[model samples]
Target: MNELDLIQQLREGDEHAFKTLVESYQDLVYNTALGIVQNAEDAEDISQEVFIKVYRSVHTFKGESKISTWLYRITVSTALDLLRSRKSKKRFSFLQRLFGDNNEPLQEVPDFNHPGVALDQKENAARLFKAINQLPENQKVAFTLHKLEDLSYQEISEVMKVSVSAVESLMHRAKQNLKKILEKDNEE
Candidate 1:
């Protein structure tokens, strides 16, 4: 079905349309979340949450932008929310640990390497992603959309609600920042 037809069906509460939506966009949503949150399990959870959000809130989506843009916004927002929640929990846990016997076991941080990387390249990929994570929010989103999602400047502009030139500037800055971060990592 065309996007228009799918959207209309979705607004009409068609079950098939919802299923098609999930099937068509799950990878996009999942990868975007993974790029942001840098965790596979959390990305999977965020992907499901994004769809549930779309299923609940599709009616609020005005047709001013493409469905994918809307999905991108939702995926980014949900992933960032998870990150913020995790950060707050971590901070609170640090405080809680100071005064009592903590029973929670600390797990090793999972390698956040891309799935397609070979074993030898996993370290490089993980290091690259860690630097990407350190970017300012706009630069990180633009870089992820362009590099990870293979989106053009026009597509990223639409998703980010920014001008194409702004996206260009963000991409340039992200590359420069990543270079510096990786260089520092190498030194350390």
Candidate 2:
């Protein structure tokens, strides 16, 4: 069925439709959460919370935009809110111990099952993720929605509740920041 049909089913309180919706977008939701929280555990928790929020609020969706667009907006908002809450905690001693002052020399995760990812690729992904985590919240969200999720500027602007020009500027600055970080990593 089409997304509109699925949404109509959801609006009619079809539990199966809700599950289908969740199953379809769970990865997008989880990855967005992961980008914000920067911890798998917290991301998982926030992803669950996002789905719950969606369940409660799905009826409010007016179909003015695609359901995916609405869901992306909800996902990004929830993730950013979680990040903002974490920022108010007053300390990052845990991170200090994990990444240390220099930020190079990331700890490795042994994933024997995924030979597609070379060790270097894994390390690079980790470093990239760490760099992303350091970005200002808006830039991080903009970058993740664009770079990681492969959403277009129009889609991202809709999700972020920003103008297309604003999304373009955000993406431009995010690329500049990420390039600088990668160049520094090369030197190290």
Candidate 3:
């Protein structure tokens, strides 16, 4: 079915349509979330949240962009929200440990192995992901969508609600930042 037909069915609360939509875009949503959040479990949670948000707000979708673009925006926002909440929780936990009676040690999260990466490239991919994670939020989003998700500048602009030139600038800055970050890592 065409996107408009799918949207129409979704607006009418058709479960089958929703299921089809989920099946069609689940990989895209999950991969985008995984790329940003860098954890399989967190990515799965964010992907579910993205679908819920889509279901709740499908009626508000004005068809200003492609359905895929809308889904991309939702996935990015949901992943970022989860990341921010995780950061805040970690900060709160640290403060609690410092001030209170809690004696639990913080566990280190292992490096995420992206399933799409080749076996030989896994180590390099991990390092790249670490560098990407250090980027400012906007640059990170642009870089992930462009490099990982293989999105065009126009598609990223639509998803980010920014101009194409702005997306280009973000990608350029992201590449420069990644180079510096990787070089610094190597020198250490």
Candidate 4:
């Protein structure tokens, strides 16, 4: 069935349609989350949350954009929410420590190794991801969608709610930033 038909079935509360939708887009959602959050477990959790939001809000979805574009927006929003929550928790924990109630230690996120990357490229990919994590949010999203997800500039523009030219500019700046970050790391 076409995406429109699947969406119509989903709106009609067809369980099988929902299942098929999840099956088809699970990897896309998960990988997008992983790229942002840099953790497999968090990515998996965010993927589930993305579907939950989709199921709950599908009826409100207008057909202005493609389903995949909608999914990308959801995944990016969920992942960023998680990241913001994590930052808030870290600050809270730091305050608790300052007040002498420290019971929890700050946890560091480890380097992410995307499973789809070739074994020979895993080490380089890990370093690249580390650099990506340091990018400002817009550049990070644009770079991840383009480089990791292999999305076109136009598709990313739609997902990001920006013009195609804006996406192109973001990609260019992201590349330059990544190069500088990697170079500095190498020099050290």
Instruction: Report, for all candidates in order, the number of backbone clashes.
Output: 0, 0, 0, 0
Stretches of candidate 2 off by over 4 Å are 91-119, 182-188
User: What global local distance difference test value does model 1 have?
Assistant: 0.89
TM-score of each: 0.89, 0.78, 0.95, 0.94
CA lDDT scores, all candidates in order: 0.89, 0.77, 0.94, 0.94
Pairs in clash, predicted candidate 2: none
For residue 81, give model 1's deviation from the true position in Å: 1.0
The reply for model 4, stretches above 4 Å from the true place, is 103-105
Model 2 CA RMSD to the hidden true structure, in angstroms: 5.7
Q: Compared with the true structure, what per-residue lDDT tens digits does model 2 show for residues 9-109?
A: 98898999999998998988887677666677777888899889888888898888887788777877777887777665423544654757545444443
Could you tell which candidate, 1 or 3, scores higher by TM-score? 3
Residue pairs with backbone overlap in model 1 = none
Candidate 3 lDDT tens digits, 23-51? 99999999999999999999999999999
Error of 4 at 145 (Å): 0.7
Candidate 3 contains a number of clashing pairs equal to: 0
In model 1, the Cα lDDT at residue 92 comes to 75
Better lDDT candidate (2, 3): 3
Give the Å error, residue 39, model 4: 0.9
Write the residue-wise lDDT of candidate 1 on 1-188 in tens digits.
99889988999999999999999999999999989998888899999999999989888888788889999999988987888798788777766776565657555566688885689988888888889888998899999988889999999998888899999999999999999999998899
Better of 1 and 2 by lDDT: 1
